[model samples]
Target chain A: MLDHPTRIGRLALVGLGLIGSSIARGARANDLVDTIVAIDRDPAVLERVRTLGLADHVTDDLAAGVAEADLVILCVPVGAVGPVTAALAGALKPGAILSDVGSVKGAVMAAAAPHVPDHAAFVPAHPVAGTEQSGPDAGFATLFQGRWCILTPPEGTPPEAVARVRGFWEGLGSVVETMTAAHHDLVLAITSHVPHLIAYNIVGTAADLETVTQSEVIKFSAGGFRDFTRIAASDPTMWRDVFLNNKEAVLEVLGRFNEDLAALARAIRWDDGDALHALFTRTRAIRRGIVAMGQETAEPDFGRRGAKG
Target chain B: MLDHPTRIGRLALVGLGLIGSSIARGARANDLVDTIVAIDRDPAVLERVRTLGLADHVTDDLAAGVAEADLVILCVPVGAVGPVTAALAGALKPGAILSDVGSVKGAVMAAAAPHVPDHAAFVPAHPVAGTEQSGPDAGFATLFQGRWCILTPPEGTPPEAVARVRGFWEGLGSVVETMTAAHHDLVLAITSHVPHLIAYNIVGTAADLETVTQSEVIKFSAGGFRDFTRIAASDPTMWRDVFLNNKEAVLEVLGRFNEDLAALARAIRWDDGDALHALFTRTRAIRRGIVAMGQETAEPDFGRRGAKG
Candidate 1:
């Protein structure tokens, strides 16, 4: 009802998966947008979106979906951003803002920039939140509550467009931060991309071990491997695209990880308990910092004990 | 009132940390033991144990603590098992069942077997359960519910002793599995030791990154690094001992991990999205197995969203 630019007359969400569906639900719950137009190439996804009543209008046609939308947010995999943007860019209303929820900003910005029309703004975003689950059913209205949403607007982007996008994320209960697309990719490579790669790699290694039975790994996973499995179980297509797109930063960080792991392996082999203890002790402080910053739960085992039921 | 072999007249737990105190609480809660004698070299731990009423008797004297106990379980770190066992073996009651809850069974068996008297039985156990938090206050009665407890009784051990130890674990709500000490160490090296080592290694890697600010890592940890931090935050002394004692199996498994990771990295560098997708998809089956087997919670984000309140 307010005349502020933050309020959207029509918001178009491309792809009705977890992030896209959650954005639709959150926007409606927060009254940040008057109407939502849900679009997906997959007819099944569009049907599901209609059944769930996630948006005011649903369609498989990209151009129709974004026809009159004041804002369009691409919530598909990073690899799909370019093609989807190109297909719908001409249909976008003049002065509309184009944003996305992709994890890697630099690559997404590169892919999406050329397709964005001069009349529209492109603001790349990465919400640092998710469950291992995927699909529309996996998302909730509160998925982004108390989580960080990073925005990386390309150079010369209109400040008003970025503000409106930031305001939309803030309305969905996210703390917004701004940085360069390059810096965002670098930070996320260490914090997210490489971590996921290692988790997937280790789970694969455990699965392929000749001496250990699969049943044994599955049964005794609670020790620590199960934690890795949770992240490793994340959406495969999305993660593959993440690694494929953010190759440089992920490889750079992974190289450091391998170097550090080699030293730890050496220390263990040589019975350097003090070295192991020191590193182990130092790592606890980082966990404490994360918990203290409200980015993680202080509850033991992520409060899984009570959730066991 | 039950006269089962699992019932203990006096059970001595040699350390009052997370695992030890949890045993005390579980034993008392299920009425598996008549009395628990809590022993620790640290006065503060003994005081905390007493204040929490975790055991019937609390003392710093290892010898005095196990004087007439029918079952003596060494609950200290694996590195301290030898010294603690040697210090108390002579004071053990005749025909007592000597056992432990160490993570690495083979090393613990080698350390404690020589000191144990002929009249006693040495049963090494590794309960595949725990949280990151430690100390008496962090212990809970339901810690081992629906968890696995692996027992590695050395050859020529009395069947009655193994049965009693197995029965005791069952009373604590654990499903018991018996295997050779060597296999237990190998199984645990992959399932627990190396997972923890890499978790510690990656967390250290992130903390030491010159390019990324520590504040940034802490702020964006929800992306996946935080799960690693949970396991990396475990007891430093205990984890150090696990790595040192289980060196051979851990290094062997770690070598495999490094090799697998190299292949995964190559796939990423060369843009083999198909290979990355195949591995990522395969790992999700293991997670489903863990959850189906009741070793993990099926809830998303470990049900942390609801716990946030």
Candidate 2:
């Protein structure tokens, strides 16, 4: 076995939410970071972090939290990335690497780039992993295991800094991929953002229906709506920021989705069973590919039955 | 324990897909039926059912299979309910209660009603439970445990038949509810049909994207797309029939969904984070209600992580 040295010294995390705390936990569990400093605007969150012992130090002060850190990651909502970076950029150590875990990369890059000092490299990354749950306690050390984390470093950034950021995420059990911020945003819009939007939209539609009572919808959700509700139940502030920041990509993908959905509705209206069957069959192949590639669980119903039984 | 008599003397299932095979397994495991006869249009399904020992008697002849059955369930797709009933209704035993497990109750009720013999009663039921898997091999004895089974017996049907059918489902561990077939279709249109359509649509859209490669979409699916893929991978013929049969209600609900989605799109375009946040927040409560009502798994990620680990 090869000796794995600590990749980050005095790692400072801004916002001890799900992503931030998971990074802290994963880094500590894997010995990837020498020291973890958890920073959040909420005092209660800082208190919870201390109680959970998730970090070596917990603070509400941005500058004090990040001072002298080898790596600083902003794990706040995409909308907050700009403000947080602006507030804390001046305090980043000369050689420290600045990164983030926002879902939308292009907006995050645009928001955070100007604030980042010339001495520090800004690497925007989106870890394509998370549960619908939020808060400090919702994170686990193994959350990033077997998941994809895309790093979108701006043009002309040092290769060593990009490589180091890649090493940090890989050390925490993530498979890192490098891509441009614009491409990352477009890819994520179809893969994550639009999916989440439709989920939220469907859940809202079901809830507001006058003919179907909420009680009936709740009782009968096991049919399919329950699955949508799981993702729709995700952190609202985070998702809201995601949609706002990734507006162009999300809307572009959503336009294609609407057009496809219209065709499906037309098929159903015209009683074109073959068309619906063809589409459904094609979709099944995509799922099989996802499962075969090990991105999704192979167990039926996500092995949800085992949890109950 | 109370002495529980067999609810069904001889059960004849018209299709040996996921629902049919599950009924056989649940019935046999709970001693709800003394004998089971599985009939399918496909000989392979019959052979598999026999190999699995899912039923005492397996055959492809619909009339021969229902010779002396006390209860005959048509577990075929919604589109086949009419033809299957027309083929088997003449053979139903006098005093036998007939039921079906189609998702669209109104269409099933209409299609099967005129063909029912004077001495036999028809009850259309929608079991609001299933995995995406299909076929006889994909079933388990506990599939219906603690799940909702809605019974829609046509008006003026004998009360005893409805009671006996309810008892049969309850014996198989389902919580039974009785409603009008029309209302059941309308409710399920929003709860199941439209949700399925959108899931299928989004998956198809993602698959057809020009800019984003399918590999990237599959790799980054954990962000939320994987959940949609699970349901989108369901039996194509079954779902295609569901949308075709429940066309009006599905179209009606889908219109409202489009309207709500348009509003959400407007909010995103205008960067109305508050509106997006409010909707996302409201949707979370619905998920809580689903979990509280025991209709969904409360464990995070549907316990998929545990399965992987």
Candidate 3:
């Protein structure tokens, strides 16, 4: 923890969705801020902020939320970042640090970095955690606990501002890692974007199968399809925005995924048992690595209980 | 709960893997059997069957396991159905009921139905529940609890055998449904096989990533990759056997899946946000339907806790 009296002066959170509300709660829970202000286009969202007590002040005006704030966080969908940044550009305090909790870094940086105050810190960041549930009610104080929040600061950004931003997230129980924009987008495309696309695609296929029927897919899903549905059940608008925003990285990994799937399809068609065995065997090790890395809990209860719903 | 003696006169289990051992244990746990005879050509498996106490008698000899069995269950991998059936054709008792717990029904019937004794019942069954884990120790008596069991009995099979087998699975707490063999295969190929292939492919892509290191993939897996690994962590040999045995239905579903995925990839490449959004939106309803049907639980705890290794 830095001794600079914390990054607790003032905070501006744009948007009042799940991610935004979670950050507000998380920031307040850790006493990491002096004042929290949230902005959303919908007055209903402001009412939610009031009811949830997630912020000190709430307004439908994005610009009004940034006034007097020392830190401005964009928590809107990726597609909205550009327009929202433009709206708040003139309202941010001179010494404020600007960051985001967007899913894709390159797109988000492209959208918001240009409008950042030259004297201020433009530390583009992505807190890599969320649920399929949406709206203000879906968030909680501990949403980012033990999750990774990647900070993709542009070159020559003020180091002190970056450290303070890092401290803010760290106090809320996130493990912050610094990454280049390209690497962050590429990593997330494989880890999140592409996988989500595949899940959506498979669920789409199941939905379209005239012979199989939707009822059958639902009934027999415990075999494995249930897992895909769980992921595909995510908010459509948010996911579409992510895949669209991270096009290059998503397509690159998706190409690789296509090749592998085609090879597997070939193995199945040719009845190449050994090739199938080898690939399946190789993947088991990766699963072990994930379990070892503490990313996925080893207990079946978490997965099963999620699938059960 | 019947008044008559609950003991099965003699039972033959055709494999000693996950589901097979689970059935053995469930039967033993429920006093549902008088004698259990397990068969497998693999030496290690025979040792496992004995080690797990899955049988009153165990052997690498197929004939020995089937010779006096009043009920014969083909619980081997889908690919093994044909060979095992051929091996045990002459050994089955005259009136013994022949059933299977294969994942793919049409193929199971194609492989085992022709060899069945005319007087014996051939009930093709699939219990649509499993963890990615496999092997004797991986099984528990509760594996089938609250799961769906599908029976694709041949057209002329005796009603009594179906009822008996249904009673057995019902005792284990599965809800049983009936469908034609071909229909069952197609339904499962879409619901189980294709989704598994998609998960396996995405996980494979993550493993092969040169851009994002494996450690990074593991660390950030909760972003989405972790769920795919849960499905991909399924047993290799068993899955290899599944694809090989259920070739037709799997190929058909895979064909549809690839076409749908290609369409989505094209939409992403061309920045067709509407198309992506529309498809994603459509699939979300299916998820809601699954939730309504009690197939999957909703996302309750988005705040992930550490895996208890």
Q: Which candidate is the best by DockQ?
A: 2
Rank by lDDT, descending? 1, 2, 3
On DockQ, who's better, 1 or 3?
A: 1
Encode model 2's per-residue lDDT on B1-309: one tens digit a residue. Answer: 124543788999999999999999998888888889999989899889878999988888999999899999999989899988899888888999889999998877788799999989988888888999999999988899988999998889998889988988888888999999889999998888898999999999999999999999999999899899989999999999999889999999999999999999999999898999999999999999988877777888887843232
Comparing candidate 1 with candidate 2, which one achieves the higher TM-score? 1
List model 3 lDDT by residue over B1-309, tens digit each.
334333468889887778988898888887777889988777898898888778999988888779999888988788788778878888888888888888887777887788887767788889998878777777888888778999988787788888888888887778999998888888888888878877777888888878789889987887788888887888887788888878899989889888998999999889899999898888888878877776677655322456531
Steric overlap count per candidate = 0, 0, 6
DockQ numbers for every candidate? 0.75, 0.76, 0.61
Tens digits of lDDT, candidate 1, B217-279: 998998999999999999999999999999999999999999999999999999999999999
For candidate 1, give fnat to 2 decimals.
Answer: 0.78
Cα error, residue B51 of model 2, in Å, equals 1.3
> After best superposition, candidate 2 residue A72: deviation in angstroms?
0.2
DockQ of candidate 3, scored on C-alphas against the true complex (2 decimals): 0.61
- The segments of candidate 2 whose C-alpha lies over 4 angstroms from its true place after superposition are A1-6, A305-309, B1-6, B306-309
Clashing residue pairs in candidate 1, if any?
none
TM per prediction:
0.98, 0.98, 0.94
Query: How far in Å is the alpha carbon of B50 misplaced in model 1?
Result: 1.3
Clashing pairs for model 3 are A297-B307, A308-B296, A308-B297, A309-B296, A309-B297, A309-B298
